[model samples]
Target: MHQLSLLGTGLIGMFYTQSLHQYQPGVRVAHVYSRRKERAEKFAADWDIPRWSTDLDAAINDPHTDTVLIGLPNHLHKTAILKAAAAGKAILCTKPLAMNAAEALEVLEAVEAAGVFHGYLEDLCYTPKTLKALQAVQNGALGQVLWTRSREAHPGPHSDWFWDPTRSGGGAIIDMGCHCIEIGRNFIGKQVQPLEVVCWADTLVKPIDAEDNAVGLIRYESGALSQFDVSWTYRGGMDLRDEVAGENGTIRLDHWLRTGFELFTETGMGGYVAEKAESETGWLFPVGDEVNALGYVHMFRDMFEAMDAGTAPMETFYDGYVVNAIMDACYRS
Candidate 1:
C-alpha cells in the first residue's frame, strides 16, 4: 500500500485524492495539508484522512506517509519539493514544476541529489486516447512524427492565484501551455531535443497583466515542429484537441468538445457540468467520471505501480523541467 501525504486543499488536490481513494485500492491519503486550517480540516474530513494539518512540514514528515502529492500553487512548488525531498519522501508534483526554468532546475537538482523518486503529474498526457496514440506511435503505426499540435483552452482557471502573474507565473501559457508542450514531446519523442521556440502572446481579452491568448511553435532537433495555442478568452466550454502527422499516416484526438457524452439543458443541471464549463444552462458537457476522464486514474496507477516495480514512471521530474525550459523560451521569444 502506498500511503500519501496530500498537500493543498484545492481542486487539484481534490482530484488527486479522488483518484487515489475512489479508484486505486490500497492507495490511501494518509495525511492532508492546507495553508488554511479550516480547509485542511474540511479536506481531511471529506476525504476521511487519518490526519490533517496546516503545517506543510508536519504533513510531509508524517511517518505513515511514504509519498507526497503536491497540488499546491505554482509559487509553492519549490518549497514543497525541497521539503518533501529533504524528508526523504517520494514526490509527485503538479504541472509546470516551477515558475520558470531556473527554479525548475534548482528543484530538479535537489530531488536528484536527495535520490528520491519523483513523478511529474501531467495528467493530459495520460488520457486514455492519448495513451493509445502514444503506444501506436511507439509501434511505428505512424512513420516518423514530423508535426504535432495540441490545444487546450477554456474560460480561465478556477483559482484566483492563477490570474496573478507573481503567483501563477505567466497567464495562459503557464496555465495551459505546459500541457500542450509535454503532449508534443510524447507524440514526437522526448529524446529529440527542442531546438528553438517562437511564440506570440498578448493580453487580448482578460483584464490581467499576463498574456490571455498565445500561440507557440517548438522546433525539434529532428525537424519536427510542435504547435500549441492557449486562450482564456474562449467563450464555450473547454476545448481540448490534438493532432499528429508522420511520414506515412496521421492521428487526431479531441478530448472535450466531442467527448462521446454531451447534454443540453435549457434551464440548467443545477449542478456543476464540467471543469471550466462556461455555462451549465446551454449545452453541457458533463464527464461521467472526472477522475478517469481527466487521466488521474491511469496516472496514479502508473506512478504507484512503477514504485512497486522499482522502475521509472512514464512522466518524471525531468519531463517537467524540460517543459519549463520550453515555457521559458516561449516567454523569451
Candidate 2:
C-alpha cells in the first residue's frame, strides 16, 4: 500500500482526502500538515488521519510517507514540491503548478533530478462529461474542430489569500481560467500548439488586486480557437459549462447545473449543495458524491495506479507548466 502525506487542510485538501479514502483503497493518507497547529490537529482528527503536523518538512520526511500530495496555496507549491522531491517521495500537486512557468520549471527540474513520480491534479479535464465529450470529438463526432469554450465562475474563492494576487497568482483568470484553458486544449488536441492569446480582464466584483472577471482566446497552429471566460461575481451557485463546435457537429456540457437531485425548501436546507453555493435553501441541485462528480475519485485512483506501474498519469508537471505559460501569455495580452 502507498502511504501518503497531505499538505494543506483547506477545502481542496479535504475533498482529496475524502476521495482517496472512498475510492483508492490501495493508498492512504497517513499524515496531514497545516501551517496552523490547531487547524492541523482538528483536521486530522476530523478526517481520522494517523498523524498531523505544522512542519511541512516533517510530514514529507516521514518514513512511512511514500507520496506527498500538495493542495496548498499557489505560492507555496514550489517549496513543498521541492522538499518532497528531495525526499524521493512521489508528488501530486494541484493545478496551475506554480506562480509562473519559471517557478514551474524549477519544480520540473527537481522532480526529474530526484526521479520521483509526479501527477498534476487537473480534475476538470478528467470529469466523466468531459471525457465523453473528448471521446466523441476524437471519434469524429466533431469533424475538424473549429472552436471550443469553457467557463468556470462562482461568487469568489473560499479563502482570503486568494484575494491577494501575490499569493494566489492572479484572480479568476489564473484561479479558474486554468481549468477552462486546459479543458479547451484537451478538446483541441494536446499536440496542437497555441500560437497566440488575446485577453481582457478586470475587477468587476470583489475589491482585489487581481482580476475578478476575465476572458481569453487562444489561437492554435491548427487554425482552431479556444476561448474561456471566468468570473468571481456570478450569483446563485457555481457555474461550470463548456462548448465545442466543429464542422460536422457541436458539443455542449453543463457540469454544475445538471440536476440529479432537486429540492424546493420553505425554510432552508441543511449543509452545502456545491462549492461556492450561496444558499442551500429554495430550489437546489444537490449533487450526489461531489467527489465522484468532480472527478477527484478517478484522479487519485489513476495517480496511484500510475505510480505503482512506474508510468506518468494523464496530467503531469509538464502539463501544468504549459498551462501556466499559456496563462502568463493571457495576463500579458
Clash number for every model? 0, 0
State every prediction's TM-score relative to the real structure: 0.98, 0.98
| 194-264: candidate 1 lDDT, tens digit per residue | 99999999999878889999999999999999999999988788999999999999999998878888887
lDDT of 2 by residue, 27-108 (tens): 7899999999999999999988999999988999999889999999999999999999999999999988999989998999
User: Against the true structure, candidate 1 has what lDDT?
Assistant: 0.93
lDDT of 2 at 181: 93
The Cα local distance difference test for each model comes to 0.93, 0.91
Query: What overall lDDT, based on C-alpha atoms, would model 2 receive against the true structure?
Result: 0.91
Runs off by more than 4 Å, candidate 1: none
For lDDT, the strongest prediction is 1
